[model samples]
Target: MSQLRRILVDAFETEVALRRVFLWLPAAAGAGVVSYMAADREPSLWLLVPLTAAFAGLAFLARGRRLAFFLLCGLCAFFAGDLSAAWRSARVAAPIIDRTTIGVVEGFIEQMDFRRAGARFVLRVHAIEGLAAAATPYRVRLSIHRAPPFEAGAYVRLKARLLPPAHASLPGGYDFAKDAWFARIGGVGNALGRIETAAPPAPPGLALRTMMALDRGRNALARRIDQIVGGDAGAIAAAMVTGKRDLLSDAAKDVIREAGIFHIITISGVQMTLVAAIFFVGFRRLLALSPTLALRYPIKKWSAALAMAGAVFYDVATGSRVGTERALFMTLIMLGAVLLDRQALTMRNLAFAALIVILTEPESIMGASFQLSFAAVAALVAVYEARMAAAAADREDGLILRARAVEGERLRLFWRACKNLLARGPGGLLFATFCATAATASFMAYNFHELSPYVLIGNPLTLTVIEVFAVPGALIGTLLYPLGLDAWVWRYVGLGIDGIMWAAAEIGRLPGATLHLPAFAPWSIIFLTLAMLCSVLWRTAVFRAMALPLAVIGVWGALCGPSFDMAVAPNGEAAAFRGQDGRLAVIASRPSLFASEQWLRADADGRPAREAVKKDACDKVGCVGYLADGRSLSLVFDKAAFAEDCGRADIIVTPLFAPAGCAAGLVIDRDELKETGAITLLFTASGVARRAARTPDEDRPWSPAPRRKWGPSSRPFAASRPTRAASSDLDPSSVARAAGEAPGSVEDEDGDASPLE
Candidate 1:
């Protein structure tokens, strides 16, 4: 302890500590935001007051000591993050639909998106037929089957089935409700009937008018591009420029996502940097043409300023998302660094940019886009920095200069120059891609429970086409469109998009291209993130060495985490259980597709739902699922089946309320399911472990506790005498070979496996 204190004191007193102290302040702030987000219950209203006061008091008390002062300042930043998130959450608080409703919805269209299934409209609600004014949400997202006659800002009325924002289906799944809450989106549903135009009761504000105009212009540009390029390629090209991603089919999106090059389609750092570089290079060369004037002026700074302006315009023009805005912020900061004659590509600049983003949207810390984007950038930058340092060292030692001076080495030098080009171009891109993929793999698994193993190949192929063809086409096409000569440019743009799609398809079809894994505890992600931060951000070798063990622990935890034996859907319409063969046995032939898909992903089972439910004995009465331990779990539909199921089965699940006396060891009925939300159970050799999407203890506004209309059974099933409580769970077929079974082999349930009924 004394040695540690001395080390800390010495660190703070040194000049190096000054730089290191500021470098970690943003991370400290993010840690505080994470703390706030991880809370099961909301903190008190005045909690920040005490936190701030404590920080201030500590700072003043240790003002004379630099070490203590630095620690207190970090504490102050932490407090600020927590306070910022709380205030932002409160500011965005809006009414969310509590229950599903079929009503006439009237509103001005705020946005429209094309999807494979239908068009989605974001409505600025004027009214909901059955809901009161005070209860109605300001914004509602609705899926409309056909193209609406009107565009954004056009007032319209439609009959729709609107539902309350939904929570995740199972534990550790994405929380849509939380995202909706932060986005101020109160409800989401499908339009049922015709949409009719209606006059607005009041004129929209000036800001709304400007936003609507921008949307209209984007639509026009997309239409023009579609006319020239055509097909899915054109739609993709437009998406790259105008952000109309809904134009692509879901299959295409899936292919791209699985290939791990989906970032290219989105307006992210790659696109933004490409845009900035175009202007910066073009303007710099243009100014260089006039050498007399260029030598007397700061043309590089002028070019950087112009590039930043272009990037900002592109971000706004493309319908800026959080990801786009983040990329734009980084670009602006990098360019601003150039203008100020400061090094732009350092981690310090990245940290400064991160601070701005964290302060502006603290809630984004919980989002996949924010995490993945920043992680990828940090990894690439760190790798580049290391590479530059090594190259500089070689140059300083005169290794290259000394070798180049030997005339007999000319042929070797020529080959070496070619190799260097390869290294700087494709080889460099490949290495950078690997670094980014490695950095984001944990985050990817955390968010989607999958990893794109072939991303190393896929990204290089797609991104090369993007940087070489698509970006240039977009720039040239947009410029020449006014002159009525962009048609030719778009044709080549379509060719480039075709290359990207072809790569996506081929890579996606590769065996084991995507590895889906079971969800792990949140701590796994935290550990992995910490490991990456320590590895890249620390200046000392001792601190950096800590990353290896942290990474190992994180990987071990993620891969060896407990897998749930069974999962029930949020609405009690579907459920799946792990079979003896280790594959999922969905209980319902006609299960909710979304629920079934999510359940399969959570289990790391890639089979389609129809294939998974084939062996289940499902009928109008109910379905019976066989557990690995030879126990049966019955999903009862008709109450008549309850008598037989409750007597024979170990567990019973039903939408209807269970009878007073159930012989089953466990029962989860409608009321219980409603209160608990979706549930997952892990039946291990020790015992049965249960988890829920939303528990009674979960008090977040996004997932409130349901109003209990009925009480639980008085009888304790555990106290029943006949059914013995035993730890007799069997291992999956992978390990059940000891019990006279072949590896990955088990007898199928002797029942029908027809299809989704």
Candidate 2:
């Protein structure tokens, strides 16, 4: 009895400590690392080294408790893994000669890329031709043009120009550079006519053929389903089945986006959770039915193993990076628990899973999918564990036992079961969704500087449907596969999804479905994360209550923060060509790329909105009038362009290069004025004002001295502060009069007058 007591006490103690570590330590350490990255001027690796040593010491000192030690080690390892991955990426990226023509390119196609011109593929390059001196080979993204009809599995070789990824000139453009970097894609381009099919055999040991075969089958089924459902239904169904959302139409996608159901587009947590639950329930039932099998072996253990196998198959079929990683990590945990004959929900399992994934691919740790997936799982596990602990504590108090007759005990158990179900199911799902959305929003806001206000509603609905559908669909797909009816099954599934799409579209069309919140401040996300952490970690009711207020404050900050669209000068003088909705508006100055493109992609980072606000031909340099969703924002190339039909111009912006006669009313060119010997003035109307220049005899507080050299091409001088029309009509030599002062005055500077040559 004493031995048993000691074992129970040890198990309980270890479990509690492990819980504290996994549930809380990660957030603490993550905070520290992120803080260090932000605050330190000259980052000291030694600071982390000490922390690393301390973690290692903690692991070693906790002798009998292997789980706690492994967790600490895992946390430290993740930190190290992040640094290593970043370092390696930097090293590999540094040596590659930019614009070098000679490099041996080799890699299989990662995925089929559909472009307007033709079907291309994203090739993962292994080598470059001329730069053999560069030891480490980084992956390059190649766009194969005019490919001989190819599917995702096909392998081809192409000699193409490797250019650096494009950067956003303005704030809101998508940073392909960052995305490509994380994806380990170093270059992107089309084939240069020399293309060949180099169908390489699958690698020796890994599950390449099996994975490919599964992918091919899934794709084939999806295509057939697409054919059956046709159009939007087919696209939605294909996405549901194979996790391929690229086929979805803009209208269908917009509906999903507005409904906050875009999470359904990705097969990760929803599918995995359902898969695990089904296996757990089905296997428990099977064991109950068969006493002989139940007595001999642990049915739950076998169920977990089978569940893992299903997850593996599901991941391969989808090939979503996040899904694959999460499924693999979770499966590893289950498999490890099975081998140890331990409960799968322990802190050790989560740690081991995290360690495996980080050690394999550290870059994934930084991605939104990984962060959100782990956050949801962590939140769920923590919530469940807390409930179990509370129940156990209640039992230990004996107050419940003293009051319980047989009927009373039965009622108590029923109530406790109900509580557990509610806590772990609906409550847990909601909390998990909340945490994930918060974290993702924060990350996106910091990176893209924009927030989709509808996500609060969108994600929950989407995740709920996904959770409802993913498992049932996977199971039905598998069951029907053996009976040669999977295709037929998916055909109906496609039809059902199409109906959902219609509903979502209707929802999107409703008034104010998507509220566009400007990019958030950094501290807003930080405080929000803090509030979320407090809610999860704090035990006292008073402390927990604080989380709500903090969350509200954080959200308020996010909603009313500095917009990335506006470029403000250091002195607080700022300008933006912005729509009333706070989106960038059309300007006469350097054509606003994003303004012209009707569809703007909001980056989560607190950066400028660099994507096109409209998808019109206005992406290029030219005057354009954007008409999308019944709203028009016009731009004129000539000086002082007019919008006849539209309402009064909400905001007028002039590029620095706007013709001398052009009047935009507001000019955003602080840098241009600082660099060039020119001063821009903004007034209520088109006008010219002249102030006498300070002479040497007249003392001035702070003034720039006038300097001059002979004109590069001397011409006859025309003296005057030219009117808009005079300036517009002036010869090149005469235009130089205002700067150096000409001999004769020739024109009038009238206020609010139209500048027509």
Task: Give the per-residue lDDT of model 2 (tens digit) for 270-342.
Answer: 6666766677678778776888878887786777777677667666667647645666677657665775687
lDDT of each: 0.76, 0.49
lDDT of 1 by residue, 1-757 (tens): 9998777556444525537557778888898888887777776559896886799799889989877887998898888788878777888888898766789999888877755455777788989998899999988877777776668879998897777665666776766677778878788877888899988999999988877877877777787887788778888888887887767765676888889888767777788888889999999999889978698999999999989889988888889877777788888989999999888888887888788888888988888888888898888888888778766774564566565687765666576567667768878888888888888888899877889999998878777777888789888988888898989988988888888888889989999988988878768887899898877776566666779999998988897765788887665556788889978877753565555667788788766555766443888878888888787888877666655676678887776666645567877766666677778888766666887777466677677666644555222324222553222222233212211211110001110110100
- Which ten residues in a row are the worst by lDDT in model 1? 745-754
Q: Given candidate 1, what's the lDDT at residue 308? A: 89
After superposition on all C-alphas, the RMSD of every candidate to the true structure, in Å, is: 8.3, 12.8
With a 3 Å backbone cut-off (N, CA, C), the pairs that clash in candidate 1 are 614-753
Evaluated against the true structure, the overall lDDT of model 2 is 0.49
Looking at candidate 2, what is the lDDT of residue 434?
67
User: Model 2 TM-score?
Assistant: 0.64
Per-prediction TM-score to the true structure, in the order listed = 0.86, 0.64
Best TM-score among the predictions, by candidate number: 1
| The candidate that achieves the highest lDDT relative to the unseen native structure | 1
